[model samples]
Target: MSVTPRTHVRTTALVLPAVLAAALGACSSFDQGTRGIADALTLYRPEVVQGNFVSKEQVAALQPGMTRLQVRDILGTPLVTSVFHQNRWDYIFTMKRQGVEPQRYRLTAYFEGDTLARFDGDDMPSEAEFVQRISRERKVKVPPLQATEDQLAKFPVTPGAEPASSDKGAAPSGAQPALSYPPLEPAR
Candidate 1:
């Protein structure tokens, strides 16, 4: 039997949609695969920093017989506090950044009664050293020192030079004068 022009057109119309649907379904998987590859090849990874950050100076300040409130004041709030363990506080810190090994630190502070008895954890970083480490990694530009003591020393100081007064012909303390202002614009 000879296929008519109408039959050919109907077959093509039905087959075309089926083929397109198959192609579109395949494209979705291909798109997902490409996304996976792109993600794998991505160079920029966001730095993941979490939990309570305790410094060496803060830990050093934590002496025996110190109150829980005092410990919290020095080292900030604890990251982990168990309901079961009423006298224990856990401080955990983790840092994950691109092109750097992940760092994890855990500190456990045990309390006897209401006072902090002792603490055990990895060695902490000093405030200054921690600042330097973070700044160096982020490539932050530090401004140069301006008008240093040596630079200021070059200028001779005038004898009996009174400092400049900020309040020029101002009212005396505890004086409440009359209040006046321009009328407010009417609301639209």
Candidate 2:
């Protein structure tokens, strides 16, 4: 038998790792119960945070210069409102999460000369002008009045509601100031 060269043996050993790495990377299917391994490596759950808005007060303080988007940022999207007047928008949010005091909200915004100027229905006003107009004598349905540490801790409204993210697994991990008025995007 011819003698095997030590150099040849070393070269063969060097290539063995690369070959195994390529083959393992290309293998997509596995013949075992290890499919759960991939799932365990990737898991996520959405955390839902509810708002506390007392209806019948905040809904009535809308003003002109406010766009449809601005209202959506504040009280969230409405359930239903007058379709005849496009300016009159309504927002409704559920308060009860799993049988804890059922929360219901309703807000109506009125317009003058085709521009929103007034509102009424439900929800407490958070604006100074609206607060001034509201009479403490009548029952005023409003949010927590002032955001608390707990309320702010969860579902804390960030300025501009923050832009929606398309990238995966990215989340703000701290309390952020609520966004100021964001200009309306041009209709595409």
Candidate 3:
């Protein structure tokens, strides 16, 4: 009976400390996390970022009287264009990276004769920004061209080798029809 009480006392003593240890362990982890966060706050440092950038204040100085060559010297070539309007040109300069000053420049040009008649400008966004805006604008997808059958064909395109296809659908080689076809439709 005495041994049973002593065993029970020892077991209770052992279990009580373990229960207390488990309870305290959780609080210690929270303390550790708080200390870790404090250490991170003290040791952490912010970084400075940089990117290719330009300012309009620089381009605004460009004047209407400036020639094509002079404009090229001041600003780089256009980014986008249509072949039909050679007179109109667009200039773009962009910057990338976060936590740093933005550097970007853009100019849309309209030329009269040889002189630059007018130009408009704004800051250029990063490549990421450019892609995001472009996506919103909805562009059609076009795959690059592979070689065509003509390019791969061993046969020559000479007149004798290839028969000409007339705009009108003519009958293949055969005896002439005994009856004439109906008359064509008249112009409106």
The TM-score of predicted model 2 comes to: 0.29
Lowest-lDDT window of 10 residues in candidate 3?
A: 45-54
- Which candidate number would show the highest lDDT if scored against the true structure? 1
**1-188 per-residue lDDT for model 2 (tens digits):** 66579877887899999999888766744524567886666555322324434334344434555766666565566656566856666554444333245545555666554446766655444545334333335655667668769877897667867656686656654656667866699656
C-alpha RMSD by candidate, in order: 6.3, 22.0, 16.7
What TM-score goes with each of the models?
0.62, 0.29, 0.33
> Runs in model 1 with CA error above 4 Å?
1-44, 136-152, 162-188
lDDT of 3 at 176: 77
Error of 1 at 161 (Å): 2.7
* Number of the candidate with higher TM-score, 1 or 2: 1
Stretches of model 2 off by over 4 angstroms after superposition: 1-77, 124-188
Q: Write model 3 residue lDDT over 82-148, tens digit each, in one string.
A: 7988888776555443434655555687888779898876754544455543353556566877878
Clashing pairs in 3: 53-103
Q: Hey, what RMSD does candidate 2 come out at?
A: 22.0
Clashing pairs in 1: none
Native-referenced Cα lDDT, model 3: 0.65
lDDT of 1 by residue, 1-188 (tens): 99999999999999999999999999999999899889889877677878988889888888989999998998888999999999999999987867789888889999999998999999988777667656536656668878888899998689966544589866555557659866699667
